[model samples]
Structure formats: structure tokens, C-alpha cells
Target: MGQVIYKERKNTNSTKWDDCLEKFGKEDLLPLWVADMDFEAPACVKEALQKYLDQGVFGYYKHSDGYEQAFMNWEASHHQYQVEKDWIRFAPGVVPAINWLLHILTNEGDPVLIMPPVYYPFKDALVNNHRTIVECPLIRRDTGYVMDYEGFEKSIVEQGVKLFVLCSPHNPVGRVWKEEELRKVMDICKKHQVYVISDEIHQDLEMSGYHHIPTATVGDYDEILVTLTAATKTFNLAACQNSIVIIPDAKLRERYDEYLTRIRISGGNSFGYIAVQSAYEEGAEWLKELLGIIEGNYRYLRETLEKELPKVWISNLEGTYLMWIDLGAYVRPEDMEKVVRDDCGLAVDYGAWFGSGENETFIRVNLATRRENIELAAERLIKAIK
Candidate 1:
């Protein structure tokens, strides 16, 4: 309903902007990479943080019941998933939780399963923990990306996969998985007695005409399911370093809690708790506005590129502010950096990073920015390709 006021993030130690040279080997390129938005955080989050700042007593803090209730209320209202307070866990971010869960649920050499062309961090979490990475690549179609259910099951069977990291409303590919698909995959995992950790950080950023379904509600696999999410992604509070880890089974929670205790990590900072609680309590309308902006940016980028580059294929953005585009028709994998970065002067997430080499020709663009930024990106992309 209200207009989103865009903010400049060029020199504020922003990862998506100021670190482009370090990350993409380029400087001053129009950055359309990374998942963080180019807008200021919701009013409620900022106001809450300011209120905390106004109180100069910055000491050791503990999470209040109100903090947990806010998240529980958000889950119930937003996704229709009723979460109990005891089922929740705390993490500074989802990636760390993934790594922690990997260590908690599986052995060092145990094989972990993941769909390729997914969130790159899933691979990092698996490999960094000395786990065998098992790849079951998602099958890409005209409509969008879909699961290879048969391949998934076969990989789980052959590799003896004990942990499966799922990206619901998958990153880079931008496919908000349907209920039936979730059921099928969970059923397979249930059959194999595999533990699943669904990275749902992007759970709240669905585009118009789309709804995000929390994977925990899909089936009776709570004993083996761990849902990781964060208000940081939804409310642009990533710097707050706070995330929610929901484990329905008491035994699994106990195991995760033991790992946390062993590592001497208890919870996040006071700012993270205050910001997240405020966001879940009063940021609904702000989110509604942000989603509309993302959808508009996606439509503009798609129409501009599709009209100019006939072979360019932009995947339908069902959820998240990320867009996956195939520039293979115009550029080869070997020249992706040259065409996209050197020639077009744009910093983007290379598709190869999301997978091995199957997606070498694709590029993932972040659409959670000003419309003018998207327009500039479109113009640069079309010019470089043509």
C-alpha cells in the first residue's frame, strides 16, 4: 500500500555492494548479486532497534518469552503452521545452523544429499564439515525447476544419505515447491530414514499469486525434519545475525541442544532479538509492499530481456527476489564472467557456483532493489549480449 523508500548502500560496508571487488573481481560494477535487499529495513525493526539503542545499558541479555511468541505467532498466521515454544532453537544465522545440524545428525564421512543449482551454502556446509556431498540435480523444465524424485530416492539409497538439505522455494532457481512435491520428497526420506534440514530463509518473500508452504507441515517427518528460517531475510535485518531453528521432535532438539552446549554457543545478541521480534509482530504490511516491488522488478527484467535477446530464458519467479536467467544462447560458460561482468559491467551470481557445470551458462540476479537498478541491469545485459 505504501511506497518503499529505496536507500543507497554503496559505502556502508555492505556485502552486496562494497565487497563486489573482493567477491566478483570487479569494482564499481552495478551490483545485482547477493540476497539482501537495497531498501531500508521495515519501520518496526528500525524503531525497535532505535528504542534498544536509546537504552544505553548494553549488557548480557537473554531472550524473553515475547520474543519466541512473536515467531510462533508469525508461523501460525503466515504459513498456518502452529509452532510450540519448546520446539524452537536459536542460531545467529541459518548457514551455521545447517553446519551444526550436519554435525549433530550425521558422521564425518556420512553422505549428505542436496539438489544441485541450489543455494551454494548448502554445498559449503556439507564440504566444510567433512561430509560426503551427494548431488541429485533438479530437473529444469519450461515451467520451472522440479525435483527428480526417482533420482533423489536412488541417491539416498545408494549413498546411504543420512542428511538431506532442502531449499524450499529453492534459491537461484526460484521455485517455491508445491505441497505434493514436498510430500513426495519427504516420503522418500521417510522410507530411507533420512534426516532433512530444510533451509527456508526465503520463506516469506513469495511473489504475487504464490504462497510459501513450510516443509515441516508437509508430512509426519518431524522426528527427522529441522526447519531453519530467519526474519533477517524477510525484513532486511541480516546484519542482526539472528535466525529461527524449528525442530518438532523432542529427541532431535535434545541432540541439537547438546551440540550447541558443547560448542559454547547459546543464542544471538540483544539487537537481533529485538529486531526480529518487532518484525514478526508489526512488519506484515511492509512485507506486502516489498513483495509487490520484487514482482514488478522481475516482470520488468523478464520482458526487457526476452524482447531483446530471443534465446534468453528467465525462469518464472514463484518466490524469493532472485531471478535465474540462461544467457547460454548468447554467451558460453567460458566467457560468462567476461560477458556478464567485464562487458556488461554487472556483478551477478554465476550459475556454476550453484552447481557443478550443468548450469554454467545461467546467472542468478537479485531483484530486491530499486526499479531503476533493474532497468539499468536489463539495459546493460541486452547491450552486452547483442
Candidate 2:
């Protein structure tokens, strides 16, 4: 019981669990939709954050040399991508960084491309920033979701797409883009001079065997790619609101750098910088353990569905703890979001809102929670499905 208490999120205003009723318009639903996990951050991270908090002097701060080195070391050691300290630029979060990219790079009505059934925000970010969205939805095949390079190539030209916002280890539908896939996309982007802004925030949460391939590594087209990532997702540090836009090309970096400065919004939050440095420096083993827990939860859900609710379909998840459940078998035209909330008491992302067809009835569940909660949610869902 005490072990479970360690991960206490109650009263923390935890967006994933604590405040879901306000978000989904219901009070008693089990929240499993958002990507954040329910486990306690590593002891090392808590200690580091507390050390700063105890100082009691909260003021504006900048990225120290150690903070920059943490980025360099983690990228090289974990993902095998070598990045110089100068390349990493701070942002409040990756989504905000995406919005900023739209404003800085594209003029009004310039098209920004995204592959859907994605994170959903990709579309919102474009529309809110006054950029048109060009969709190149991933091709679902036996091997999993693919780039649909042929459709993608044609769209890049047809839409006159200036920027391609890509999700590596794609969300909702979890397929980590292989190096070969990246090579092809990068080549196409280079051919058309389309700037590639990759949201690699989930880069660190990959399941055991699959490794994340950095877009900046695939080709010599240095200036064209700006990779966005952070410790926010990895360590549950979103409250710190820290994200890094890794800009390898100095000239391109300078353009964004100048824009961020003019707005006075680029410095990022003080706690974010502090947390990221500490998480990378001492939290690797804890992350490894956390991955094991997440993988187990995934396996449990799969087995439960197979044995108890064989009709439901689950996407073959490769990276991230987010699970996409295909509910096309059970969806009605009007009661899509209602069925899950009322019948099952499970809160999940409606697939229709993610630019998928109405027939593609699906939902997303996050598995970064305790094993007990996972079982309870699955049991409740199995009853609902029946």
C-alpha cells in the first residue's frame, strides 16, 4: 500500500488522472487517455528538484553548460545521435515549438503537412497558427504503419507544402520510423526544399528492442531538419515545461533564435532546465525499470483482450506507452465518445477526431500507470465490451 502511495497524484492537479472529469465532462470515469504516466519519478529526480525548490529563490535562469552537456551526452549515449551543444534550442514544450515554427517559417496560408491519426494537436497547432494542414496519413500494412512514400511524394508537390511536421515513433498508432523510412522522407524533403520539423518528444520511451532513429542523422541535409524533444514526457516533468528544439544548422537556428528572443518567450521555464539536467545525469536506471513496467502493462492488456474480449483490435505498439484500440466493431455513428464514457467508464481519445474516417473507430489508452489500476480499467472495459 505504501509503495502505491509513493506515486500519489491526487491533489497534484495531475492532468492525466486528477482533473479528467473537468476535461471529458464526466466525474466518475477512469482516466487513461493522456500520455503521462502515473508512477513516481525516480528518487534521484525528486531529490534534485527538491534541492532547487528548497533554495526558495525562484528567478529567471538560463541554460548552464552542464545543461547543454546533458543534452549532448543523452543523445549520443542513448540514441546514437551526436549533437553539439550549440544545436539545442530551448522551448516551453514541443507543441509550442511546433506553433512557433509555423509562425516563423510559413506565411499566412502556407501549408504545413502532418501524418494523421497522430497526436491530434498537430492539426490544431497548424490551424491555430493560421497554416493549412496537408495530411499524408500513414499506410497501414502487415508490417505496421508505413510512410506511404508514393502518396507522400505526390502530396509534397501537390500541396506545395513548405514544412513537414513529422512524428518519429509516431503517437496513437505506434510505429517507430526506421532509418530507411527516415532516409526516404529526408531525401524527399530535401528534393523539394521542404523544411522538416520532427517532434521526437517520445524518443526516450521506446520499448526494449526498438531504437529511435534521429532525423538529423539520416542525411547530410543539415540545415533542413529541426528536431524537437524534451525530458517532459520521459520524466513526467511537463509542469517544468522544458523542451529543446535541436537545430543543427546554425543559420536556421539563428532565424528561430532571433524570433524567440524578440518575443521574450524562448528562455523556457527555470524548473524545466533544472529537472532535465538532473533526469539525464542520474535517472537512466530508473527509466529502464519504468520501461519494464510499461511493457508488462501492455502485455497484460493484450492478453486480457485476447482471452476475455477477442473481438477488439489493438495496434501493434512499438514505442511509447500509448495504446491504440480499434473499436470499429462496436462504434455507432452518433455515440462514439459516449459509449466509452457511459458503458465502460474508460476515458480515451476518440479516433474520429484524429483525422481518421468514421469507420476507423478507435481509442487510445495510456499504460504508464500502476499494475492494479491497469487491471481495474481492463476489467471494467471487458465488462463494457461484452
The candidate scoring highest on TM-score is 1
| Model 1 lDDT tens row, 1-386 | 36466999999999999998899887999998888999998888888989889988999998789999999999999999999999999999999899899889999999999999988989998889999999999998996889999999999998899989999889988898999999999999998899999999999989878899999898889888999999999999999999999998999999998999999999889999999999999999999899989998999899989888978987899999999999988898999999999998999999999996659999999998999999999988888888
- lDDT for model 2, please: 0.83
Task: TM-score each candidate.
Answer: 0.98, 0.95
Task: Tell me the lDDT of candidate 1.
Answer: 0.91
Scanning candidate 2 in windows of ten residues, the lowest lDDT window is 1-10
* Cα lDDT of model 2 by residue, 6-31, tens digit: 37676678887677678788866777
User: Which candidate ranks first by lDDT, i.e. highest?
Assistant: 1
Angstrom error at residue 207, model 1: 1.2
Pairs that collide in candidate 1 are: none
TM-score of model 1 (CA atoms): 0.98
Candidate 1 off by > 4 Å: 1-3
